[model samples]
Target: MTTAPADATVRVRYFAGARAAAGIPEETIRLAAGATVRDLVAELGSRHGDGLTRVLTACSFLLDGISVRDHGITLVDGSGVDVLPPFAGG
Candidate 1:
């Protein structure tokens, strides 16, 4: 298996509908060493165009399973950031 750099930037992974909506399986996002989760969102929004604003508003962010609402939350390299929306069904 190929290995990534130790200080390599973050990698964003979208699941289920998010992946389809984003139109990409995954992305290697380049962020500042101490970029915040909010920063990542903005970066992604830029990449996805204006549609991202609406989509992102409906989604919840998770850092390694911990729900994150504070935009100021600092992100480190190799961290997992999940963009999740509410699930519906009976």
Candidate 2:
């Protein structure tokens, strides 16, 4: 596993099913300087377990309030990431 740069941090916010799966509303995750959203998901999967992995596959992500579809997008330090699982009704 890659280690986080000393000064890099990503705040992850979980909503709905994601929150239920992670058992928390939010968490601060450390990452290497150039880590991507995919990396963050991998780390979270490792930390949280398979349930989160499954939930994540059906979720949408937002980076600092902007919707992000590419998991390869590099993350900015001290940015906030929101994990939004699908809602039953629009």
Candidate 3:
């Protein structure tokens, strides 16, 4: 039988400037169960320091391929989040 996990495992993808600032294209973050997006974001900011925190401020997020408009949304185990910074073009 399958058992529930004690923590939520989030797969995070960073794009463009966000990726550059984070120095990694993607990563797996383990957060406490019932933790919200806000909590995850806060943890990231604290983990990566000021440069990433700045980039995160201007970036938009997609949770499991859907845009996340609410930071309070709770994260479940195996959630995938994308951090997309502004892209420059014509």
Candidate 4:
């Protein structure tokens, strides 16, 4: 399990649908120790409003370019997390 600091700040990159919803490509989210990606999403939802929930649920997490299928993945300071939603096309 990875431990985070009380002042930990992680860089989050929003892609595809998530980017469109967030209206930004990236942001630095602060959290307490042991904060997970899920936690970050919840926090973001609160800041951005309830509509974020619908979009966040469809997004997958990535750490340093590696997919994090596990929702329990711990987040720490300086970590780079990517939010990627499934692409829809013909």
Q: Each candidate's lDDT (Cα)?
A: 0.77, 0.93, 0.92, 0.83
**lDDT tens digits by residue: candidate 2, 1-90:** 986555459999999999999999999999888889999999998999999999999999999999998999998788999999998976
> By lDDT, highest first, what's the ranking?
2, 3, 4, 1
Whole-model lDDT, model 2: 0.93
Q: Across residues 1-88, which tens digit of lDDT does each residue of candidate 1 receive? A: 9765344277777765667678887788878766788889888888887665567767888887788978798887778888876677
Per-residue CA lDDT of candidate 4, range 1-90, in tens?
Answer: 975456659898888888888878999888888888778888888877766668998888888789898877888788898888888898
- Cand. 4 TM to true fold: 0.85
What is every candidate's alpha-carbon RMSD to the true fold? 5.6, 4.2, 2.5, 3.6
- Top lDDT model: 2
TM-score of each: 0.79, 0.90, 0.91, 0.85
Clashes of each: 0, 0, 0, 0
TM-score of 3: 0.91
CA displacement after TM-score superposition, residue 50 of candidate 4 (Å): 2.1
Q: Which segments of model 4 are wrong by more than 4 Å?
A: 1-6
Error of 4 at 18 (Å): 0.6
